[model samples]
Target: MADRPTGDTSLPPRAAEFLELRPLLFAIAYRVLGRVTEAEDVVQDTWLHYQDVTERPRSPKAYLSTVVTRLSINVLSSARVRREEYIGEWFPEPLLEDPYQEPERAAELADSVSTAALVLMERLSPLERAAFVLREVFGFDYAAIADTLGRSQSACRQLVVRARRHMARGRARFAADRRAQQELAARFFAAIADGDVDQLRDLLAADVQLVTDTGGNAPAPPRPIVGVENTVRVLASVLPELGRVGLRLEPQPINGEPGALARDREGNLVQAITLETGEGRIRTIRSVSNPDKLTHLGPVADPWQLARDYRESRRRQR
Candidate 1:
């Protein structure tokens, strides 16, 4: 039985245990589902299921893990269709802060939660995603993973292997230097705010991809703008428009990567930009502008309406 919080002694022993491991359970579900709301629902559902258990488990963490994974997989089964029908490019909802922290596996933890890694994992089946996350990202043994999924150890290993093949690009990643990432991000956003197309070009890799997901709620390209020149051109064009609309950009860390948060005049978050870097330059610029995704950050504004307002303002000026 885990101890209750100081001064809150009425909390049940098992309930206290669940409270302590809530972050880990949420992390497991988030990695499996890639959506904050769904992952959180799974955690709550796990607690409800745990309350009904009559006997104590040998390991509370294992029990909680199994429950959360199962709930997350159930959600994932139905999520595939919704994702396919999503209005625009569907990226994982940006997370401003991760509750779970594995200091011993910090590098692996960071890489696994990256936007690129989550997008690539979308190719894997639901069970494969669960098994691979438990075994590879969290370093669970084969036996425990199998028990969690109610599959044979060999079957679990096969799922992980296949998942690895699908997500090979995410393998063996090391955490980037935080200071370096922040410094680079500072310069990059400064260039955007200044409308320095040439500086933006130099900061971008030769084959960078600028991807934005507005989910059709806001005006944006439906697909990624690939290559340095195209990305630079698009970025440069948007600068004046965003400035006209009074959408301010500020440097911030998003999903373990250097990124920025954009807000409209009302201080409503309009965009969460995450930058992936390699070779000392930006490789991918993922911006999640879908207001639904930005809810986690804070109040979200109507970017499409903002777009119209700014365009109308330009017309009046003309």
Candidate 2:
């Protein structure tokens, strides 16, 4: 156990303890709930409850972890209902920033937070997901996990086993090298920008699938666009329009994986496009266009920038 910090004179001891455990608390909340804003809210609620504690526990970190876990479970339960009524195939809000504190465990951290892992977790029961994250991702002992989840140690272990079995099928099956993945993503968008359908097909698997969430504000296939040929055709079909509107794709990391951030000519962000590759080819491409979800991404691209740039380019062409 790490040493608890001495609180500021103006602050309560419990408040100071929360600040010390905040990073881990937020990590637990975010991974459990899969929403940044919601996770922050959960942490805030935990602080409110902790500050009012008349009796401080012997282990502040453990106490705080328990509080966050319970709150997150409650949040996830209600959120599942709302997700069922969401406008389209919902995707977890992209975690543009990596928030893991342990540099030595960065790779492990990245694996846990990858879009695929987060998506697969949706299939898990709230208790199952909480058990896996606390034990597998955060290295909590089975006893600690049991205490946090209010389950028996044996039950906590069973939950983790069950969650792993459910997630094992979708775990990364391709190269784990980030550099290689980044190069592949760069080539993918380059091919898209050049309208090279053959190149796109070569980079995709036979069953390649694309899922886009525009939240009904922009045009997107209502259902997942699947299959190599069909996916290529749909993507290629958009190139002419993209060129006409001066929309360009730049390789950027999204949710810790190599991806493309679409921007207009003026460099405002339009979309966050992430790729999940396996067996040496692209398997899933996720493009999130929900404006409400992109607030943390900074400087949204003007919707009309494409047309404005097209007009300017045409003017110069003359």
Candidate 1: 10-residue stretch with minimal lDDT: 1-10
Model 2 CA deviation exceeding 4 Å by range: 1-16, 265-268, 299-318
**Model 1 vs. true fold: TM:** 0.93
- Candidate 1 lDDT over 238-257, as tens digits, reads 66777887889888777778
lDDT of 1: 0.85
How many angstroms is residue 162 displaced in model 1 relative to the true structure, after the best TM-score fit? Answer: 0.8
lDDT per residue for candidate 2 within 1-318, as digits (tens), equals 223334566665666778878889988898998888898889888887786688998999888999999999999998998877788867777787766578888878888888888889999999999999998899999999988888999999899999999999767666687777777787888898788888899999898999988767556667998999989988887655666676778787877888877877677778888999876688899998776667667777654445455557667656
Tell me the spans in candidate 1 whose CA falls farther than 4 Å from its real position.
1-10, 169-177
RMSD after Cα superposition, model 2: 4.6
The ten-residue window of minimal lDDT in model 2 covers: 1-10
lDDT to native, each model: 0.85, 0.82
